[model samples]
Target: MRFRIAAALLTTAAIGLAGCSTGAQASDPNGPLRVAVSPQPHGEILEFVDEELAERAGLDLEIETFSDYNRPNEALTQGELEANYYQHQPFLDEYRTEKGGEFAWVQPVHLEPLAVYSKEHRSLQDLPQGAKVTLSNDPANRLRGLKLLADNGVLRLKPEVSESARVEEAVAENPKNLELSTLSPDQLPRTVEEADAAIVNGNYALKANLKNPVAIESAEGSPYVNGLVTTPQLKDDPRVVKLAELLRSPEVAEFIRQNYTKETVVPAA
Candidate 1:
């Protein structure tokens, strides 16, 4: 396994401290641990830890924020970052397979339900035939979004298509003949403005302040909860472990509920 789960957090924290004890960077008292995160909630959550919790835990935290979801895992795999906090396991699994890099994830901290927001359409049924609908360009999210549409009776996948099916396999049935277009997670908001509606990652939806999406991923047992992803080498680094702990702390949970509305983001179970 690229990242082995720790038997207990105490044991992991001890391992992390051991790696961080030496002046690895030689300048700071606590060696700097570089982590990549998404802008809205992940970055906000990290900022809080970087500001409020890390110093007390004796961890020097540095943040790299990404608008696009592509760079974090690539950075981690290439040794540019120690860990990242913006992606779910399904995405990590698909990315590792597609991009040919090894990656692993820790326990999830939060679920950012993918949602569909519209500028012109009042409801999915109301959207005219051939209405352009933007979906995630990434296969995992695209399939999930298409599945949401499928569950709602808007479209269906071919019988042979698996749960993680991509766009090519998704036209099993389109009664309304709605035109589905693909867009990267970052661009979904702008695409939604131009198109009839777009299934959007929750962070981007919140960043764009898009209201009343025609569809949203069900929060119950959603596979899209974001978590810490790290290279196998740094999986036990104390600073990384500390950051993961802080991410799941009560304070962070309260902060998330307070800052981002409960209706959108929820702490992972």
Candidate 2:
């Protein structure tokens, strides 16, 4: 896991060294809206808009599919993409704070609920001591995933920890001493099949066809619904507005609500 993280960091650094637009040649006022997206719901939803509604609305949509959780933000920051739809506001807040980038938020399109999946263990209680578990490593998601452990009595967290908490902030009262590993959200689904358990992002879960999670984040109060994001300068671009409007339309919402399992993917209101 350590080796994988190191390699991922190196990949990120390579992107920085190679990419240089800096959100300058940002977006076309009337051209295709180049947007980055995760491979599942984000990509699937955008493809729907692009094929079914874009021409009618006079919006030419170009979609860039990103399988890596970190790259979309980097691409958006580097102007390799005009906007992205693969992250929540918490992630955007953490990214802005970490990179000092001015990524702006549009409305949330859908919710990919975080879930705990395991091929080895049927439930959290079944997980034995020192069992290796993989989770999303990014600050916001690390906190959110860890809170599932805390919430389900598998572990305990420090008092006053809010939605933005990180793994290092976690003071676990884990009697089992479950060995925890943090990976990118995109990596968790695959790792869970090998490790004792994993807290996977719903998008990856469905993409990989991993099923029957032992635990899930509820839609009632979950905050990780993915939204459209853009550079501050392009926030009000007509293309962006049209894309956002189409994404949240009844048509798209019905597609999400029908095409995906309600437990794994929920259309955000």
Best by TM-score: 2
Per-residue alpha-carbon lDDT of candidate 2 for residues 1-269, written as tens digits (9 for 90 to 100): 00111334544553664465435454546556778777678878888887787778887777766556677787777766679898898888877777787788988888888889888788999999899888887778888888888878888898877655656567558778888888877778778658999898887789888788899888876678889999888898888888889999999999998899976788887
> How many steric overlaps are in each model, in order?
1, 0
**Overall lDDT per candidate, in order of appearance:** 0.75, 0.79
Model 2: lDDT of residue 54: 79
Query: How high is the lDDT of residue 126 in model 2?
Result: 95
lDDT for model 1 comes to 0.75
Q: Write the per-residue lDDT of candidate 1 for residues 1-269, one digit (tens) a residue.
A: 01121224423443454445442222222457777777678878888888888878887777766544666666666565678898888888887877777676765899888887888877787878888999888888888888888887887777656545668676688988888888777888898769888888888878888777777778888888899988666667776778788889999898888888654678887
C-alpha TM-score for every candidate: 0.83, 0.86
